[model samples]
Target: MNVLSENNSITETAILVNPNLGHPRFLEIDQKLKKKKFQTCLLFISDKRDPAYIRDYLNDRIKIVPILDYKWQSQLLLERERKEKKGFLTKVKHFFKRKKKQISELLSQKKIEKTQRRLESLKSRVYRGSPIFPSILEVRSVLTHSIHDLEYINNEYCIPQDYLIKNHAFETLDVFYEIKIEFTLADELLDLFRIRNFIMFDIVQEKNGITERINYHSLVVSKNNWHDFTFVQATDLHLAQRNDRIYGIIKEWMDTFKIENLELIEEAYKKDQKTKKREEQAELFKLPLKRRFVNPNNQFRIFIKLMNRKVFRNELEFVVLSGDLIDFTLLSKLPKDIKKYVDFDYDFSNWKIFKKIVLNFPQKKRRGVIKGEELLCPIFTILGNHDYRPYHYDIRWAGLYRKLGLKLEEALAVNDKLLALPISAIVKSKRALRAYWSQVNPLNDFSIKLGNNNFIFLNTGSDSFKNFLDLITGHPSLTGLTTKQIIYLQNLASHKIQQKKENSFLFLHGPPINPKGKRSFLKRLSKKISGKIITKLDEFKESVIKKIGIKKDTRIDGKFNVKTGTVSTNWSSLIEFCKNYCNLTLAGHTHSLKEFRLDDPKGLKTRVFNAPPFSLKKVENPAAVYYDVYSEIYTSAKDIEKAGPFVVQTPALGLGGYRNPDLAGAYREIVIKEDKLDSFKVKFIDR
Candidate 1:
């Protein structure tokens, strides 16, 4: 089928297609969509799952084609090439090529010195028992291959350029093909799907190798008449494949070297133990290694079940996952030499786990029916600081120490440098970006208009590594709001204002206004002196903290209190936009339920208020009264009403704020009735 057309204004819906699920192609799609100027409900063909769900949003607007017997010719060819056997001559040629590259890397004096400095820096950080350092050969090997290995593992999914260009299946702006079906959905689907956002499709050929199946899902646009709806806002779902106790054990060892290599040492000691008492002591060390942390993977599954129940009852419209959707960008591969006590793969990444848990897969027919635990509603996701992490700190550190014979401190130093790589470095490598674009949403910043309400999503960006101080003190100001993002928000806000939109809500990863109490007098003075030379600390403090009178003060720990100007860049502009345009601004990096009403529109003053904990039970029932819950905590309706035009930080839904179990698995339920903001309540998974 060949469908080609110029830019035309159609329905407010756009489809993003990524046939081969390549990162570079996805990036190209992102660039092309930005130039598009139209209001649209973006329908992305995320995976190979049958997008019958697309029918729910796109009601008879375009013709539905049932593709059958279609094969992914390019993918098949790629598989064959990957499986092709190399001859002796070819193997010899490849071996020489690799040796030449390694020799070249080792010969560079600049590279050798840089590697030695890094190794020395790592050695300096270790203060434990007589530590074993890498040999000169090992150091040279690291210099020659570590970065290459890291980059290769990260970009493992990138398709070859030759195959990508040759594939007739590749389509982005204007669809072109010469398949049996020679019709274009472009003109018909354009008006209804005319959206400005980037869309990526996962089009898989059907079994008979003659047809194509377009797996897609549509978004609710202005054309939809339903004004009243309820949506859930969940954040910081640090999802991983498994909650390995090895990570926790490594963390314990790193904090105090007294427990260094306890597991491996115990295993070695067990064989030599003759005394019963010695065996018991070895078993004691084993206990801690076997002790697992709270499984984020399980928690997310439970959350999906709850959401499914809500959808079954017709109580929810959609879900907005603010950020921290995964613990790290890529899952760590446990050293194969290590004993496996768990049932699953040690190297199962979150992206694979996410697909298995969240999306539907082709299933064997039972009584002519297929089944899977696919979420019943659309979900929009953004990236968080954790999502930008390339590797797990604990796993990588453990690998360097145990497998590579690096000292515990040396391993820690090496891993720290890797973790501190900037956001640009992470995204450019394309591992995290690949998982995100393929499994989650494509655009980092986007806006959707549903009826009279406007929902804007922005990416606050990865962990701030502005300088050495940022790495040490963990300054929140390094969390970015790029100039482009600020401009995007400005444009969206301006458009909303021009359209006379009744209600507007802003969703971002980092909160713009986070206030904390003063530090110790000595510490404060030291920080002041250091700030002059290194970082400029935001000294903005709230004068009316006691006056606000928040009842249930959950921020008992001081860790959640990030300073005012430290949370994000373009702080003043974001605040101004929220105050003047948005009715509510929701964020979740702090991982705790905190709300602050922007009291002073011109300055950084906010009135803190306690949001009453509302449960899913109360939400399930339509007639359930919230007055009692509200009145019990708040003095009057006016006090509750004052929360309008507010900034609310929802608690994390996966990992806890201070690793507190009770504080985790929390989400917010937002209700919009008759095009007006109603209730924004924090709810927990168990409740």
Candidate 2:
């Protein structure tokens, strides 16, 4: 049946039940809903977008209901505040005690005045209107409360009402809501046996007076006899806006920077001098430097177009975005001239760009157009390292400082201090936490069920900047699975086991098992000279590689080296759980394609092989390449069953990790037939 909210004009009217709900299976449901009255809940997250606007837009066609009542939410907030006030005295006492210790340390280091000056400057920059010390203390208290609120919402069952109430919380809550739509399921809707997409719409009026009707897509499985389906796994999109401040900063830096008589440049100069080639010398001086950054918005748009083509052809079921959805949470408003770096303005432009790209908004704009090309299927996403970054770091700064004979820490002391602040401290300042909860999934970790298969998503925390060494070398412990996450996984595994699910797949942002490649003799010598120590575990791994007569770097593509603490914590336990329950595990962080099969549940033996390459030819007008890469690498479905339970890592879909453009826009296609593993192959957007 066709539903009209206001006018009968097709431009504004949407078919309440349409065959083009993104997936073929949805067509079956659409047919079933011809005249029936079955109710299904549509869930979505909203931040600044008002629920009333949605209700008004949908009119009487759907019932818009808040998950939590406003009065109840207010009562909950008041009760929470009352409890916080009760412990205020105790907290103040502890705060003063810590202040005393900090002051003493500063005095001993002879940096008391410097610390005081920094605090005063920060106060002026952050809270210009308020009294200095009081404002600083208030900011600290607010940050602490934000952390408490996030923990409470994440751990408890209450709906986050902070997003709904103005000034109720320090950061946006990104409250979740549900709507019930009545439709009938006809026999035609029941014919398809695969994932189906349910698309819903909401309208938001922007500050610029632009009216945006956003579509939120969810997946459902309708009744059918078929046992075949396909889905795509793409990761590390690193989506960012073209006008994002990071890009401008990098561009300005690149344009002004020059190498001073480097070997290659020197050789070219000498050649030009020998040949008296004035034109060549001038051209050498004007060499166009390649940019280190690529506009991920463009890459993502191409990816969406490719996926949409597959969806239209009824060849794809759904898509799984395995994290790093955007490059960073916020962009820095650093000026073109690096001399005056006093005040920085951070904004949610990147998050906004992600939303726009996903929804395919502003249909007329072609710069980052994905509006008419939004994914035709539903997508499930989790958090990754870059998604958790609140601050922007220009890597070029490190090189610039090095050339100037200045320590990066010393040169960017203020930036370092700002970056060093934990995520809890900057929750209010950064919009990443808010934007993610509001636009994407509210919970970092969640699960979805399709037929007899269960898919579990987990968040692997964020990047660490605890110390200077951590800033440079990076720390694995910072982004490893937390105790709570591990417990959650354990509970989920138990539930799936009890339900006797046919297949359970685990998705996470960080790889539990990642080994370094074998280093050359000179590299080993340099490391040894630099005081690097090889643990006993490394020695054992090397010995095992030699004994097994496998390549030295086989361990790189093999199994987990638990003792290395790569996952930081619960390494052994996570491996055990995956082996016992999970049929497949997919991760993204390394930004390179890798596959490993574990035959023993105890993780004693593993099989690793190089993946097959994509086809070289472009065949049709809708030209593309396809590879039976999984079968080529691991033989067949029977082998996968006998020695399987594989762990795979797909390459990034946006920027290439190794500066190879070909590696960008990578994704994995998984097929399941007859309730068994059919094929998992790698594909790329030829464009």
lDDT of each: 0.44, 0.46
Native-referenced Cα lDDT, model 2:
0.46
| 399-464 per-residue lDDT for model 1 (tens digits) | 323322223443454454333334322331224444455334445555656557777787788765
Cα deviation of 604, candidate 1, in Å: 8.4
Tell how far residue 393 is off in model 1, in angstroms: 1.9
TM-score of 1: 0.51
Residue 25, model 2: Cα distance from true site in angstroms: 14
lDDT of 2 by residue, 1-687 (tens): 111111211123221211112211122233243433344444333342555554444443332111111222222323333545343223333323556565455433345345433432221110001110100001000111121233432322122334323432123333444444454333423222122233222222121222222223422333332357778888988875532333334334435546452445545645555554444434443433222334566668778777765653456767888888876655443333431331111233466566667656552343223333445466777778777665555433424222212222323432432232333322323234554554444456656566677777777667533222323433233345667667767666554444343877888877654444344355345433124433322432433445555443323222222212134445556666666677777888766765655434233343321111121221111101011123345545666666556667788887655423347678888877776667777778764
Candidate with best lDDT: 2
What pairs collide in candidate 2?
A: 28-189, 29-189, 32-185, 32-186, 33-184, 33-185, 33-186, 36-184, 360-371
